[model samples]
Target chain A: MTLLDFARGPAMQFAIFIFVFGIVFRLVGVWAMRHKRDLSEPRQPSAWKGGIHGLIQHAWPYKPFRDKLMTDYVIGYVIHLGLLFVIFFYKPHILFFQDIFGFGWPALPNGVITAISIITIGALVIALVKRLTDPVRRLISNFDDYFTWFVTTLPFVTGLATAGNVWWHYETGLAIHLLSVWLLLIYFPFGKLMHAFWFGVSRYTTGSRFARRGGMA
Target chain B: MSDATTTDIPVDLESKRLTVTRPDIRFDKQGELGDDERVQKAMQHFAKDFGYIAANYMEACVHCGACAQACPFYEANPDPKLTPIWKLEPFKQAYKREAGPLSFFYKTLNLKSKVTIEQLEEWQELLYDTCTMCGRCTLVCPMSIDIATLVGMARHGMFHAGLVPHELYTVTEKAEREGSPLGATPKVFADRVEWMEDEHEVDMPLDADKADVLVLMSSIEIQKYPESMAATGKILNQMGKSWTFHTEGYEATNFGMLSGNTQWQKDMTMKIISTAEKIGAELVILPECGHAYQALRWQGANMLGRPLPFKVQHISEFLAEAVESGAIRVNKVDKSVAFHDPCQVSRRGGATPAPRKILEALGVELREPESTGNLNFCCGGGGGVITIHRADSLRYKIMGNKLEQLDATGAEMMVTSCSNCRQNFDDSGEKLHWDKQMNSLLELVAENLVEDTKS
Candidate 1:
């Protein structure tokens, strides 16, 4: 089969299957690990509240760390919001989702979608630059970190390239975009990208643990 | 940081010098050197000790560097390896290779390097000597990863590998074999109590038939600062409370927790639990030791596999409760003081308000620094870092941030509830020629006790 046909049909289905199966397997595997029962009397009434609160509090830079991370924090939000807007609000993307889920939301104007895609690409580029340039970040980052960034940034860049017909045929660009997405879906369950799911778990557990100790989680 | 000297107390350089004799305990090394045995042992330990939260922390870190800014060691040294998340690489590697969903793929692809004994030896400094397990990194981590607890688990693996620093290794060995890290045996404990009783002219009530309160002191206080023990005795006596110091279990500090030996931690905790149970004490008061409070108040029940028969209280907590209940009244002193919250007692143990309550009751003008209460900076001497004689310079360097914070408050005296913190501050103050006087909260209260009119 041609690359485009594989990317559009079987590859997409396989990526979806791996994505779903891998995420569930990872989450359940982690959950199945034995938790040593905490026999100590909790200082707080409920650890659940602390866990939920921790999730909310960590959405923004904590007060003490804000000054040092202001630029990164703002840019991170911009990238996330831009990705969400471009992913779900584009006309073609909505139709694709409708085909799968039997429901769809209204698409944004073409101009707005293009604008978000450009901004998101710019933000992702900036993030990559920071990761490569900053000493601490550069030290901790590995090939997986760079590869994840590349995969995440590729879809927006490819989509924009296709819509504007800048470098290649629209069909070829779209094929590459789908392939990049499949790569991301398969890679999502491994490496640092698991932060997408583990962030919530980490926050909740840390919050609950701190609350049990009667501290602000 | 302020240069204005507000206190008359001079820097006691001589007293600040710590004279710790390294114990002659030989580490067990039955296996062949450089073999995969130690690495396999550490990996097994990591698999056994870690749970869902630890797994989440290991997987969730994005290398954002926020935790690096929060860590005092990283702040002082600006070293990348000292970053809290970086210290967990070994454990994370173990998790990925052993328990991750894609472990088979990782093994086949050789995606990550295997953990080695040499790597663990290098991580020893990062996990124990430099990091104080202060939990400051937990506060700033955007993922909310509990890096401090992860480091603690990492220490457990290191302990199994026999990679612990000789300082901590020696002390833990002594505590396991001799029953006290400082070699404060039962006779030495009794002698110290008798000396305090004679000096203070107050009854110590040694091994009372049945006391409402059982007071536990650390070997540090017994060996170095008997005044803190004397002050605790005076406060309990003045409050007209039934209390006793059991010679069998007076040492509150647990080297097991510090040394990352779980069995030793349980054994040390059981000693105090059995003693308190035998005495029928309703409350067990931990002396001015931070880890001691954590060893009992927090992890005691978990180790015992049951809830404690008696409630454990830190001396600061006990004093705060006494003051609030009108059981002890104090004349407020007119000194401007700032409180240095010990990491274990305030941050981990949740006794932040207790010391403030006691200070407020004493009528001292309490000055709060930028980092106080739950967010208080560690004194850089906790987690057995002070025991390592070679770490003295690093401790002084890392403590510079805390010294500046305390100085910025412009208080005449710095008060803390932990003897370890006091020792750290004393060392740093003397080394830097800092002029602020350091005071223990318990001693300050004892000195300012009002004459009872009811008598």
Candidate 2:
């Protein structure tokens, strides 16, 4: 009865499959590249102490894992927290996912959700701008990096348009968001940003090897 | 004692400086390099090697300059020409001129304009002499291309091309012939051990075959740093622990850290491991040399092709180990002194804490500057960069970075865990007008020695 049903063709299904499969391939590649040399540790008394020290340094003044407080890892915490709220609780997302999986959490109130969404969108934009404009951060970014920036912004632009509730415009934004999410999933496994999944294993391996020694002497 | 009374390599307790007025040094003019025919052939060889590495290893750089930001020397200087990529140009051009895609035109038109004797000398100064090849740049390289490894390979190729530096070759040649860089044989090392035993009535064993500890010191200690070596002998004797100094394996200073010549470094490391294994020592303790600590600590197992069966500890680590194990006792230094972070001890080996721990054990008040540990600034002597005569100016510049921190510490003296760092600090401190005294962990530990009669 509505155009919303028309956009739900099988082409979207293929895109979803590519996204999930791409993530798996990335995990396999990173794991395979790790520690080609079977490394050994020299026994030291303070190895574990060193790992604890390093972890503390990384998370210092910012409880990054569970808190939304801006004091710790200011940029990292702010952007990621804003992103989580937007991706999972935006009204259009809840309705779309509710249809896809037949289950959904209550969406945040429309005004509150959009407010949070705009804040997140702003943070991400600043981050992308920083990467391009900042001399040091720009030098460190790569081809895959720019690709991530472009694709992320596309979802937000479409979602804002779809938010007007202008007769099926919401469905249009939902479709764009889903497609972007899928593309990101697929690209995840191929890039240096793959470090997200890979770094845990790398850190743990480095930690445990040196942990047994109590940290480097 | 006055500077006039100080020996050629002085042990001046008064000025709290090692007053060594070392002869002016150069690394390029030695060997078959001086002969025109050999130099020409060397040039051909240089061109080929430089061409191969640049095309194969360097051609892919995005020039993002991320690596330049990582390099401490580049960060300190901010000069584009001083950057790692630009540093390779002179060498890379040598390759382009000899065997590059357009070498034919170069050959016809004497396209060798890109390669020159003075340019070669300048590259030698910048790449070999000034640049420490610290490898920090490689970590920041998105390509993960290890510029330091490339530089070392370049050094090895340069050696094969007969362009070895006299500064390191002079030491390596001595090490090759005498089993010590001081031109001392096993007899000289043994004699020092004997002298320690007689003076202190402690029977410090020589070639204590199958001892539990293989104590390796540098030529600096054997020849000039005796008060420190005496402290070591004192500690080992007090512990009554199983330890020996291998007369043959006496020198632990690996030139790999200097020249980045991996094979030669491997040869030097293997000698220590074999000496330790032969003596059946469970511990291989490296004395106070920055690059020596790195070669053994970071590169030991790789150089040996397996896990080092014996443990490697820096002298500071060993001293801290002794303090931890209750083998040696020390009195408080009782004066405020700052610690200088050696690039090897702090950054490369991650052994910064051991000295701090030992200094704490001695109750020496440690006055730290803003940046002390792994984020440490270099002491200007690493990567064999100290020996290039042209870098005398740069040496003063970098050392001034340390001297500024030393000034801020407001301390009477500075203690470091490296001989070269101490050497650089002592020489440059006096030259650069920084009033603070510069000394080593060994010298401080020696002066604070408390003979643990209990052990």
Candidate 3:
């Protein structure tokens, strides 16, 4: 089979398997652990509402931290929002989604997606520089942090290169982009990249806990 | 430390100099536990606490470091090691090795090594001394990881390992053994209550049978700030509430919770719980103590493995209700005052409005700090940090942030409801030469109480 064929068939299938299995395994592993029930009478009465509130509230920095970490928050938002746009709003990505989920939504123009991609790549680069320069981030970061950054940024770079036909044939660039996506999928459930899913779980837990205590969750 | 003043010595022709030294604050080792035993105990306890909440929190950290800026220790020292989440390194290590989904791989690869005795010793300061469990980090975390709760859980492991700081360990031991961390024994408490009753001319009830309310006092209130007890008595009396200080469980301070001794925490909580049950109390009013409010109001039921039979309200909450309902009237004082929100009671305990309500009743001009309510800076002395003399310097440094916030308010006087926060402010203020004094909300109300003389 050709490189693009193999990449689109076996590698994609393998990555999907690992992604599905790993996520399920990781989630079940956490759920299987003992859960201590909150038996105290809730000051706010509804834990689930608190949990839902927490999930949405943590999307931005707290007001006091906003000015101090303005650059960090800006870059973080840019990178996240950029990726979200490229994934859901790009035409090719929409086609891929339609192939998998059997549904499609209208796509944003190529110009907008390209602009978002460039900005996202810029933000990703800045984020890496921050991880390397800032003491607190440097101290807390590990192989997981750097590797997740690379895998996350890789898809954007490869997608952009495939679309622009930079330094390779269109088929070859597409295969490379596909492989980078596969790498990200393979590692998503195991590394800190799993934060995409677990962040909401944690926020909900804290929100519910503090909400029950009548805290500003 | 020594002053420039010289002393006259008869034997010597020249004057001699006198030198003074600060009190020695050192770690006191617990029983003859071996390193292996301590490590074993710590790891086992860590595993026991590896529940869903912990696992999710641990997994959720994206290393954004937003929590660092929120942490007063990190802000004061600007040290990466003082980062709030970094303090949980050893605990996270234990979790990954023992209970995480990748536990097998981690164990086989030795990726996360077993927590060593030396590591536990190093973390003693990080887990206990620097952290106040204030929940500021919890509020600021983008992932909502609840770093404060994890720190508390980490302390449980540290306590089991006998790796707690000497001062904290001693205080917890005292509370566990004598039922009071600061030696406010039942006899002492009764005598103090009697003294306050005579001194304040309020009918202070002690060990009353079948009272509707059980009033709890922190050891600090009983021993150091006796006026709090009198103020509580006065408020209850003015409101015509049947309240009594039950000697069996009068101490509101929970050093067990402070020092991370789970059994001791449960025992201390049960003392108050059983006392309220015995007295057939409809409500249990916690004193102006932050952690005490936290220990009893939030964790008390969890400790008892069920919902508490009696209602728990922080003194501020009770006072707020009384004043708002006009059950107790307060004569307005013609002064503007800044209210210091205690970390645990206001930020963590979720009674931020109660103290403000009391301030409104007193009709003082409430000058708010730059950061108020849930986002207020800690007094640098909660979570039993004030009790540890070794942390005094660091605590003082962190207190600078609080001083600036309160000072910027430009209020005439500052009032706080929690005795622990007041104690911290008192200690820091004295050493810092700060002119403003920290006042207690309950006492403020007692002093301005509009007595009910109606037949």
Candidate 4:
């Protein structure tokens, strides 16, 4: 098979299987583990409110750490929301979803999607620069952190290359973008990217635990 | 005076310094030193101790660095190692290798470095001395990682590895063997209570069979600040509450918590629970000791495998409830004061509003700092750091952040509900030559009690 065909077929199937299976396995395994009962009576009656509060409250920077994290917070939100918009609303991306699920949502205008993709690439670059330059971020970051950043940024870079038809044939750029996405899917469950699933669980557990004690998360 | 001038309580700076710097007793190293066997044991403990919430926290952290900004230790020194999440490196490695998704890969490839004795030795300061387990980092983490909970889990691993600081190790050993961290025996506690009773001209019910409340005191209050005990007696008496100090479990502070030994923590908590049960007390009152409140009120039920038969309340919480219900009447004091929220009681234990209520009842002009209530800075002497002699300089250094907050308040008197916090303020206040007078909230309430009942 040609490189493009293989990248579009077998590699895509393998990546999806691993992404779905690996996430489920890890999450279920975490849940299956025996948790010691919190025998202490809660000061507050229900922990669910705290858990729900935590899910929403953590979306923004906590008040005490607000000033220190304002820049990261703004850039991070733009990158995350922009990527979501591009993934779900772009015509080509929705076509892939429609092919699998037999349904698709309304697509954004190609020009708008292109603008968001470019902005996302810029945000990711800025994030990478901050990770490399800021002393605290640099200190805590490991090889996995940089690797995840690189893999996540690749599809965006490749998509922009295809859209603008820069540096290579448009078909080749599209093929490379598809391959980069496969790499991310396979790498997602093994590294810090697992935080996508764990963040909600962590925040809910924490919020509930603290709420039960009559404190906000 | 603008309610900001109060007489400085004459403190013998030199002797007080000596009491903290040179404790009368020393903790001799007890067990075998850290070795390969100990490292393996610690790694095993890390694997065994973690449950669902801990695993979630371990995997959820994205290295956002928000926690580092909230940590007083990191803020004081700006050291990367003192970063809250960074301090969890050892525990994280053990988790990755043993229980994580990539454990099989780690076992087959052996890519990670082994947790060495030297590394564990170095981490002693990071885990025990530098960090206060104050939960400030837990509060600021965007992922809600509960870094402080995992820090305690790391301490549990360290404790199993025999890597606890000598000071904490000795104190835990003493508490395990002698029933008190300070070696205050049953007789000693009884004598102090008798002396305070005589001094205050009040009857301190001792181990009464069926009292409505059981009052528990820290060994520090008995040995160092007996006036707090006297003050508690006065308040309880004025409220017409039936309370007794149980000789069997009067010591509220648990060194087990300080040392991170789960078994010891369970044992100490059981002692208090059993004593309260034996006395048929309806409620148990923890003194102005922060960790004691954490040990008894928060972790007590989990340790005992059941909910406590009697309710546990911090003295501040009890007083707040009393003042709110009009069970106790107090004349407002004409002084400007800043209330220091103890980490264990306010942030960790969820008693933030109670102390503020008590302060309002006192009628003092309350001055709040940039960080107050749940986000208050630690007094730097918590989590057994105060007991570790070698950690003195680091503690004093970290106190810079708290001192700056208090200074900004411009309050004449600084009042806190925790004895450990009070000791920290006293020691650091003397060293920094701070002018604000340090007072206990319970004592202040006692002094300002209204004798005539309007009802």
Interface RMSD, all candidates in order, equals: 1.4, 9.9, 1.1, 1.3
- Write one digit per residue (lDDT tens) for candidate 4, span B1-455: 11011111111223332122233343322355447778987887888766787888888888877788888888878888888898888888787778876678776788556777877878888898888889898777879888877888898888887777765776676777678766577898899889989998767888788788999998777777888888998888888888899888888988887777899988888888998998888899999999898899889999998899999999999999999999898998998998889998988889999988988998899999888988888888888888776777778877777888888988888899988888787778888777775789999998898865432
- Tens digit of lDDT per residue, candidate 1, span B1-455? 01121111121223553323432332323223354777877887888776776777777888788889888888778888888888888988888787766678778888877988778878888887788888888888889888878888888888777677766766676777677877678888889889988998867889887899999998877777888878988878888888899987888989888878889998999999999999899999999989898899989999999999888888898899999999888988998999999889887778888998898888888999987888887888888887666567778887788889999998888899888888888778888888876788899888888758463
Encode model 1's per-residue lDDT on A106-191: one tens digit a residue. 99999999988888888888999999898999999988888889888888887888778785566777788889889889888776
Evaluated at residue B64, the lDDT of candidate 4 is: 74
lDDT of 3 by residue, A92-193 (tens): 999999999999999999999999999999999999999999999999998889999999999999999987779457888899999999999999988998
Off by over 4 Å in 4: B1-30, B452-455
Best by lDDT: 3
TM-score of chain A of each: 0.95, 0.71, 0.96, 0.95
Q: By DockQ, highest first, what's the ranking?
A: 3, 4, 1, 2
lDDT (tens digit, per residue) of candidate 2 on B1-455: 12111112312223322222343423354443444544465455455444332333333343445556556566567665566765665555555456544445556776446454565555565677556765555434434444664565556545544454555555555565566655456788778767766775666667776899988888666666655567677777777878888776878877654654456788888889899999898888888887787678767787788988888888888888878877677887678878887766765566767888888888867888865665566777777665445566777887887688677978777888777677677668878877666677876776677866576
Candidate 3, residue B106: how far the Cα is off, in Å: 1.8
Docking tier of model 1: it is medium
Worst 10 residues of 1 chain B by lDDT: B1-10
Higher-DockQ candidate of 1 and 3? 3
lDDT of 3 at B145: 85
Interface RMSD (Å) of model 3?
Answer: 1.1
DockQ values for all predictions? 0.71, 0.05, 0.79, 0.72
| Candidate 3 local lDDT, B208-236, one digit each (tens) | 98899999998878777899988888878
**Candidate 3 runs further than 4 Å off:** B1-25
Report how closely model 2 matches the true complex, as a DockQ value: 0.05
